[model samples]
Every structure is written in structure tokens, then in C-alpha cells.
Target: MNDQNRLPDVPLRASICMATYNGAEFVEEQLASILAQLGPDDEIVIVDDASTDDTVARIRQLADPRIRLIEAAANQGYVRSFEQAVRASRGGAIFLADQDDVWIGGRLDAMLEALATQAVVASNFDVLGGGDRPPIPRLRAADSGRHRANLWGIMVGYRAYYGCGMAFRREVLPSFVPVPAYLHESHDLWLAILGNTAGSIRHLDDSTLLRRLHESNATPRGWRSLRVILAARVVLLRLMVEARRRLRAASART
Candidate 1:
């Protein structure tokens, strides 16, 4: 262990997975926000996407033994970094975290408890910037039930959108090995949908995170214009096709 680490034994409740790339600017703030929410029982797993900045050095300066920093030999991109970090984790529950977003206190506790039976629990979040936006829509029990009624449409046509608010049981990962690298941005959608095939999966109606909107954000910052909406739909369709193919592949292996 690094001499700077101060955290004791790993917490079994949850593993916070942070995949970073040149996040030195905001990574520390995000880390502090997460650490504040954690009890001594939690653990942090970080994969540096071979950042060309001081991100690794800054992480090193933190003295928490629970903080496991894995520096990739090269830039693996966000999806690979996240997968690698979570796969190496020893925690039972894994919470997906963004390096630049701030998670609200009680977020982990709330998410963990919500997965009591389901293989995953995804909470809602508020998107900031551009305007006074309302909270992101949290999936309700009714939403899950309604979607499952038409599982085919749900799996192949509909998309379940959640990012930093998602958490999964570690065992569900083997189902994702063959996911194409190009489908990285849509990984969360793929995980939740495939999980339902193996076990129960549902979404929580609770709001648990603050998703910051910045230039680096992958999604649009404000209400979508017609052109942007059309472009987004195209991307969404591609994700669904790719994810469906991967899901079929995973099923065949079973």
C-alpha cells in the first residue's frame, strides 16, 4: 500500500468506480464529494485513462488506503477503464462514478439498499447548466413494469438512460466481455438490459446525483434543437442495434 493511504480494510457495501482522463482539473473535487458521502466501510477504485496531466499525481497525494489507483499503460478510453476498474474490485456492489460530477450524500446508501433483490439499482439525477432544468426522470416501478410488458420493444427499440446513477452486482459483468469498443458511450444501457435477462433488474424513483453539464459532457447542455434531436436519435438507434447484437451473443454463450 502507498504510505499516503489512510483507509482501513475494504468496505463490502460498495465500490466506487471512477474512470478518469485528464481530469486533474475537477477529479479532486469529485473525489472529495464522494469521500464525504462514504463511511469508513466504502472503497474507491480508480482507473486513469493514461491521462497526460497531473491526475495520477493528484490521486497519489490523497492518503486513503481505500483509494485504489490503476494507471493504464495507455489510454483505454472511458468504457475500458470503467470495465477494468470494476472487474478488479472486491466489493459486492459497484457504483459507477464520473470523475467530474458530484454525488450527493446518502447516494451510495440509497442505491445499495434499493438493490435488495434486483441485480441493479439506478437512481435519477439533475442535469445542471444552460437553463433551470427540472430533475432527470427517475424510473418508477410502473416504468419497469410497463417496459417489461413489451420486452422486445424495450430491449431492441427503447433505451434506458442512466449513467453515474447506476450500480450493479459485480457478477453481471461477464455478460459484457464481447461488447464492441465503439459502443462505449452506451455501456450503462447495455448493462441494465442484459442484467434483466439473467436476474431481476429495476430502476429507483429517487434522485441521487448532481450531473454537471460542461463542455466536456457527452450529452447536450440544453433543450435539444430539431437538428440535434435528429442526430441524437440516429446515435440512439445505433446504440440499440449494437447492444442488441451483444445481448444475443451473451445469451448464446449461456
Candidate 2:
């Protein structure tokens, strides 16, 4: 069935926000993989950040009416492009997509179901060997110092938020910080931390997204992947401290 003529019974509509740069190498394959998982009511918004390659032409070649392509005159990078895509979305639910990764079938279905009663639902991903080794989920230890790091806690930040498999409701979009200008690479972390304050973020451990580990990947997988893990930890710790200080200040005012 064509997604454009979607029926109304489906309780959810998913807007997939895809950001691209010089990703022509695998962008088509990635788009096809995602297009396959989409239900009748799903929508896709692809933001191209002025790719010097044929990425834009390749996307236009597919010409799927359901896919909306936005070309940036100049490169705004992934962070800004992603934000633009999210704002352009009209779906009741929003899912972020990476330009190079492949989504396992049924990923959206599982995540949407998991997020049914919650504010966000993120799934676990398996790393493909060609790029880098996948990191195991260690929520218990990661949550150690901060009590709010509990799966249900608001201070969990983006450390626990998996960008490849995360989805959120459309109404909450306004609360998100626009993709920051700083060179800090973890935009997902920033959104997740802010999201925690607005609503709940539930973990959907069943869905397995294939995280392709290729040298061309934005943060190519390898031993270096540990840097992202460590950075997330540091960010979470600072957020926790700030949250504590804010709470104390509120108490004093009260």
C-alpha cells in the first residue's frame, strides 16, 4: 500500500528524519532498507547537507512521493540538518535515521509499540564487524553514581539514549534544544537529557538495529568508539551535578 494513502486506524504515524552529507556511497541502500520497514502511515524527511557527491541526485532518482527531500544550499552538518528534518515532520511520532546505518525490519513497529504509553522508546543495536565492535548494554554500571540514571529517571541524559533506535512523540519537539553549534559530536545525548525532563524514556531491548561499522561512518566503529561512551559518561555526570544544584537552589528558595 502506498504510504500517501494511509488509513486512519493506525494509532501511530512515524516521521523518519534522515540527515545526509557526502554519504552517496551507501545512502541509497540505507534509504531502501528504511523504506521497507515503513508502515502505511509512515513519512520520511531527508535533509541533505550540500553533498559535493551524487547523494542528492541518487535520492532524487528513487523519486518516491512519500520521501520529502530538503537540500541545504550550504552544508549545515548532520546536527543542524537533523534538527531541520525534525521540525519539518508532520507525523505523530518521530524517529531519527543515520545516513549510513541499516534498520532491521520491524524496528519502527517495536519502537512505536514500546513508546505507546511513554515519551520515548530506544532499542538496542548490534554492531556489524566491518566497522567496529558493538558495545554491550551496561545500564546498571552506567547508572551507578546517579540515581536518576535509572531507566525511568529524568537525568539519564543521552548516554543511555541510542540514536539509531530512538523514537519520540511529535508534541514534545518544541522542548528540544536545537542542534548545538559546538563541536561536541553527541547531539543525541543533548536531546535525551532534555527529553528526560519532559517525559519518560523506556528501553526496548528486543529490537536489534544493524549498526554498520564502516571507516566512512561519521564516528566509525572501532576501539575509538569507547571515546563516545566515555564522553557520554562525562556529560551525564555533569548533568547530574547540575540537576542536584538546581534542586538544592529550589529548596533554598522554597
Candidate 3:
């Protein structure tokens, strides 16, 4: 690329967006793995959700110019944190990362390749310590582009979509962002909904990262009350309706 075509002083190829909250124990390792995959132009955009631990200090210690950290004023949960990171990022490719997971080798290239043709791409992951994957069904490559079916799988609580394994092209930022006011959690599901509704998602069968499961993991570990479960489902249903509306508006403009 020539200087005239470059993106100012830094031409970012990808931005790995991370949301952290008191994740000092494993953040450095995760960042180390991520940094290795990124080019000099690539960056890691982090939104610290008022972490009480040394997560901020550790990140600063790495001192890599590629990292851009944003400290939130108050704890607004992971969904808002991720939305902030995504909005702040300037890369053409945006990746959602957890503070504790390790990116497998080739993950960056694979996701970038998938994103080249699709608006959103979600890959699979294995447990860091060889633990069994969650009981939910894994995403299949053959299911890629099956938008209606995929959204239905999500509504029925069978689809396994996690933020750590998800990324999207920058063009889709408008569709994914400004998260619903009522969505307290499961931002990953919301992204998946938008991607499927647009009919532009790729489901990769390859495991792209090593997810570290622990007590402090962001995902809830216990079963919720029936009422809470039903409430969450209702929120997702609302999101589906919202995604359809957003896509319709976008189409009308074109």
C-alpha cells in the first residue's frame, strides 16, 4: 500500500476489542497471545469496566503502542463495555475478545478471511484445560448463511454463540451498536441476531480460541429461576424484532 492509501500514521488491519472487569489473573497471557497475532498496524481496543483489580496496570505494563485502553467512569456491565470498545476502534475488522481467553494460532487470519466476504463471523472454541464444551449445540459450517434457522436456534436456547468467539467487519457496526436499553447481558446473542437477520453471517467449525472456564467467568454458571429464563427469552425476541427493523431501514436508504 502506498502512503496516499495508508490510514495516517497507523494503518490498522484489525482491532481486537476486549472488555475487562477485575481480570488480572489471566489478562496478560491473553493479551500476549493476541499481540503475537496482530500486525504492527493492528490494535487491541480495551474498555475497562471499572475493574477493581490490577487489570489496568497489567495492560499498561505491556506498553505496546497497539493497545488503546478506555477506562469507564462506572460499571455498566460487559455489553456496554463491548459497545464502547467497538465504537472506539478504528480497524476495518473488529473482533470481540474476553479478558481471560487465549487466541489460538491462525485465529486472526481465519477470522479476517471470513470477514472479507461476510459481515459477521463466529468461530468455535475449546476449553483451556481440555474441559468439555457447554452442553449447547456447536455451530456448524454447513449451517452458515441459514439465517432464519440460525435465529430460531438462538431463540430456542440451543445455539452456542459467545463474544469471545465472535467478530465482525466494520461496516456492520451500525447494526450491532447502540445496544438495547433493556439488554443487561448476552451482547453476543444480539450481534448474532443482527448478523443472521442481514443474512451475512459465517459459522466456522474451527475452534479459534482456548476459553478459560472458571468461577469468575462472565457467563452465568448456575441455572436461573423460570421467570428469569422466560424474561431473557422475551428480551431476545424483542431483539429479533429490532434487528429486522434496523435492516429494513438500512435497505431503504440504499
lDDT value for model 1: 0.70
Off by more than 4 A, model 3: 1-11
- Which 10 consecutive positions of candidate 2 have the poorest summed lDDT? 138-147
Clashing pairs in 1: 4-63, 5-63, 6-63, 6-65, 7-65, 11-41
lDDT string, candidate 3, 1-254, tens digits = 11122335554789889999999999999999999999987889899999998998998998887888889999989889999989888899999999999999999999999999999999999999897878888899899978889999998888889989999988888878788899989999999999998999998999999999999888886777999999999999999999999889888888
Output the lDDT of residue 245, model 3. 92
| Greater-TM-score candidate between 1 and 2 | 1
Best model per lDDT: 3
Which wins on lDDT, candidate 2 or candidate 3? 3
Model 3 clash pairs?
A: none
Taking the tens digit of each residue's C-alpha lDDT, what string does model 1 give over 1-254? 23214444443777888899988988888899898887666688999999999999998888776688888999877888888878767687888898888887888877778677777776777754335433343456556544444244444334335668788876566665555555656567666656555445667776677777677765445675779556645654665565567657767887
The Cα local distance difference test for each model comes to 0.70, 0.67, 0.90
Using all chains and alpha carbons, the TM-scores for the candidates as numbered come to: 0.77, 0.75, 0.95
Worst 10 residues of 1 by lDDT: 1-10
**Candidate 3, TM-score vs. the true structure?**
0.95
- Identify the runs in model 1 with alpha carbons over 4 angstroms from their true place: 1-11, 128-138, 149-160, 220-254
- Candidate 2 collision pairs: 131-213
